[model samples]
Target chain A: MSATDAEIYATRSFTETEVPMIELKGVSRRFAKKLDVAAKLARKLGADVKEEVVHAVDHVDLRVRKGEVVGLVGESGCGKSTLGRIVAGILPQSEGQVLWNGQDVATLPGEAARTAKLRRQMIFQDPYASLNPRMRVADIVGEAPQVHGLIKRGGFDEYVDEQMRRAGLDPAFKRRYPHQFSGGQRQRIGIARALAVQPEFIVCDEAVAALDVSIQAQILNLFMRLRRELDLTYLFISHDLGVVEHLSDRVVIMYLGRVVEEAPTERVFTAANHPYTRSLLDSVPRIGNRKRAFATVKGEIPSPLNPPSGCHFHPRCPLAFDRCKVEVPKLKAVDSLHRSACHLNDRA
Target chain B: MSAPTLEVRNLCTHFFTRAGVVKAVDDVSFTVDRGKVLGLVGESGSGKTVTGFSIMGLVDAPGRIVSGSILFQGKDLATLSEEEMRHLRGNRIAMIFQDPMMTLNPVLRIDTQMIETVLAHEKVSEDEARQRSRDALGMVGIPSPDERLKSYPHQFSGGMRQRVAIAIALLHRPELIVADEPTTALDVTIQGQILAEVQKLCATTGTAMIWITHDLSVVAGLADDIAVMYAGKVVEYGDVGEVLDKPLHPYTHGLIGSVPSRNKRGEPLRQIPGMTPSLLNLPEGCAFRARCPRAQADCVQRPELREWLPARLARCHHPHREEAAAA
Candidate 1:
């Protein structure tokens, strides 16, 4: 069946009209590398040492409607994870506003703030590292709900078991520690824990990246199933384009700390407008397309500490011009649902 | 074809741990001809890495090559001494690890490492070694080889460091190179560049390579032959095009099906059920029987790796019929 036949849920048709579950407006996250005493002394002695700041996420604007799955794609240190964290509310944005259901999250009252925090949950890449080894699966899944008083009195066991079953885990194995279970099983436990809190939105940062092909498929299937059953929205961050293409309704391409392109999954894959996106699509090795010469983006990803002058991808872009080095390209609309950042687009 | 660059026959590398004997690479064998690339594909703990280590004679401590002969151009590497192996290790048989840092020394300049590698392998002058090192760096697509050669390992990016490691592996123009996921840690764009360089290197130099990785798409594109390992054994082996297009073994079929691009988007992937069994105390007979959909009672008798079809070999009691595979 074609991907366009995605009719398990009717959410996609009315997505544009619905109030976005989460919205990011010009969000930016910066991390400052403080100079040590020795470096500070060296600076005073004319050693050219100075404090540096990494703009992890810079002026990114995004919106995820209820039940929408938006895939965030980028190379390592490109700020996809940082963007996900900002959306999840775990890491506060260095600048800009985060609106939850058309309400500012930062200025929300005590009860509303608490609700907002619990409603948006995150699933990390490494299942082994994300979970608590000391705690049993039962406690890991149920603790948040219990602590938050979401569970009915004396019904904790049944509640945790239901969550486990929903995530396709055998509830009988709930008493086992994280080390006892395999990688896929541990990911399921993490999903169960997220669902236990009744989250409306989930931020999965390279969730299935560490899994083997067969196991990655199983986990991706689980994510799809959960979305259909729970009507959940997702900001799925991943480096694997194939996985992103399979699940995401919309795809957002990031470079350094900026949003370079955003479009429907099919458009992003078939007719990518951004040079970076096009190069990324070309680089993906295809099964059956054997012995073909790989078309690569020219250079290594410039260090995020001091990104390129204008377009972050300019250094590696094949069609890079003098204008690309001096002026940052704005993410302008190419189609009703498609947007791209490239000087070539303006020239055209 | 030049006595086949490397022929591994019935190789078994096991670890004698306190708990039990873990047969990491059990009765695995494959042949790589001159200028041919053999892709060793498997999931974690499938012994693909161990097989690479076995060929390089790098397995140490509890892990040892218990049986089988690694014939490198008619010479038996399995029977070779540490001294003899060392002489051939960096000179003739080179290895590029998953992490570049594992191959590169962080403290030393790139030149010192590359120059020393040349001096250890051959009677070459310092100037000649340094020039060869510079040329090798440029060969792997690294720009300004002279400047890069002076920089420390930490100065280069992840992709550049990996390129440097590959250049070191190519320093002696080794007859055989064992690359264990050399590009796995690199970005997709960088990975593409590296793959292209390696592909061209093999074709031009006739340098046989054994590439060990878990990504099927990569293997499908780059390898001439493919070996699919499961639970420390090679369950399937054949030409890359033939094996991936119409796999004879159930494990190979499932693995090819599991790739996201192969499946219809939004549908559940054709995944194999159950996890890989532990190497220690592995079940008798087929290690994949528990997860194989076509497994039968005959699977109880350990299946031999025999010819299932023309040029295709699989360890299975009941290999998938040609008709079924075509469908």
Candidate 2:
């Protein structure tokens, strides 16, 4: 495809009734411990060594419509980042299919696959780590587009300047390296780089987690402004519920590789169905909840390598019972627009 | 109210670097009474952490407490010898770092570390130390403390490891604890659990705490009083509720306004323009002047921290008045 074709495809609008911008059908990703030669030799000698497999993303299904902001909320080991990677097409799912615009990405032709790859971009959590120290800001933001044939070589500097300006960075400082910029400025550089690719979907994996509160607000505003200007769909992954509630149109709560609740943002915050979701909402330290004693879930998050047999959250769940420990609850619709994976939902 | 547990007066801990003198914690002050929690809050380079380190007598060479009186129950900690401070370090006073791994010896078992902490300050048998270690673990809400005691620090999860660190800090029933962002690295749910334990411990044991952190929400729910630090100085100090609800200083106002929940959804947040100024070779007068929306010509003169309301102090020439805040 030519540059104009890519531009046309990037700017193509879709109604909410149409196919989702991205969809995950029964997606599951597993990470297994690889045995080295020594470990293999020990295993052959009848040592009590076993390969451990971690189900990072268990048969999860999701759909994000065009221009929708889907907030994926989870704790440290909940596999939200893995799921986001799969959705961004940077990582492949061990099972099931990742559909882009109603077409399975695995089976797409050469040019179509490349286009799909280019259409999705990611903004990482740590700005200091994600960016290369050696590269100047102009090259960092301009390289991908030039390499991908999105811009002509002569128009490179102009394109980089435009992207930087859109991301709220001074293009005059584009000659400086990443180390010279502040954390928030480096994040804007990352944003500028992602926008340089002209992506329709952006996966922000804790993009503002490293910055200060005031800087966080500045970056969050830039994101909203970019969304308004470019009509972008975002998969915002964060552990902070307040940020998720502020940006997301819909919220999906994950616990130990499984999504426990999915609902409209307002519904998830107000009338959450899953016990884990309720616990998470309660656990968030809010400015309004001043001098309030926090209500914590009972135990630590279980090891994903040896997750609970039935529900992953059952061990720490306060309302867990015999059924929760013995049955793997299915994600079912609890309301017209809300879905929850909990045994209590069956009874209700 | 009887001779507050820790009263930091006119603290100035500066780093004498070759580049220049970096005033990390200059003229900072706060008071934490017994059983009360004081939150020292700021962004990075705001000198909150330096203040905590100064109070603990942990400021190494090249960084010295230039001027200050850290009155701990009528004793000035700044004047103490290294050997004397060593005695008070973990016995009567304790410090909790941000990373649990910093406190926990990875090669040793949890029991060994806790027992060593107990034995360091007291003449107790190994069995008695072990018993105290087990009790401390149990007190921090670690389930099956006996089993957990035998496990290595790596065997425990992040939250559990932090609990072990906190339990070690509590071994001597330290009269004062200086916790520098202890829960900043944990998940929110885990942080909530840890904060709950700390709150309960402070309430029941009457152990004064100075919780230094960059998060306002965490401080709001945990601290009885708060000191807002900016450019190595206390910009505002007052009761937690008053400081959060009716912030007098523009820096505090901007900080509060920038929270995600405070703004209308999908709209632009009220952001304080420009990043935090560099500590080394800082501009004259207010360090926050460049970012303050209410900054004017008068802001060029450094404002002293003075009482604006009853029990409230702010360091700003043109503070946000009550009438102005109402309007």
lDDT of 1 at B183: 90
- B1-327 per-residue lDDT for model 2 (tens digits): 389999999999999999989999999888999999999999999999989899899998799999989999999999999999999999999999999988899999988888888988999999999999999999999999999999999998899989989999999999999999999999988998999999999999999999999999999999999999998999999999888888999999999888997665566778999989989878788888888888999888989999978898999999987743473
Native-to-model Cα distance after best TM-score fit, residue A139 in candidate 1, in Å? 1.3
User: What is the TM-score of each predicted model, taking all chains together?
Assistant: 0.97, 0.96
Taking every candidate in turn, the Cα RMSD to the unseen true structure, in Å, is 2.1, 4.0
Best model per DockQ: 1
Query: TM-score of A-chain in each prediction?
Result: 0.94, 0.94
Model 1 CAPRI quality:
medium
Per-residue alpha-carbon lDDT of candidate 1 for residues B1-327, written as tens digits (9 for 90 to 100): 359999999999999999989999999999999999999999999999999999999999899999999999999999999999999998999999999987789899999999999999889889999999999999999999999999999999889999999999999999999999999988899999999999999999999999999999999889999999998899999999888888889998888888887777788788888888888867789999899899889888899999977778999988886743565
- Write the residue-wise lDDT of candidate 1 on A42-110 in tens digits: 999999886899999999999887777889999999999999999999999999999999899999999
Q: Which stretches of candidate 1 lie over 4 Å from their true place?
A: A1-18, A38-50, B324-327
Report model 2's TM-score to 2 decimal places.
0.96
Query: What fraction of the native alpha-carbon contacts across the interface, defined at 8 angstroms, is recovered by model 2?
Result: 0.71
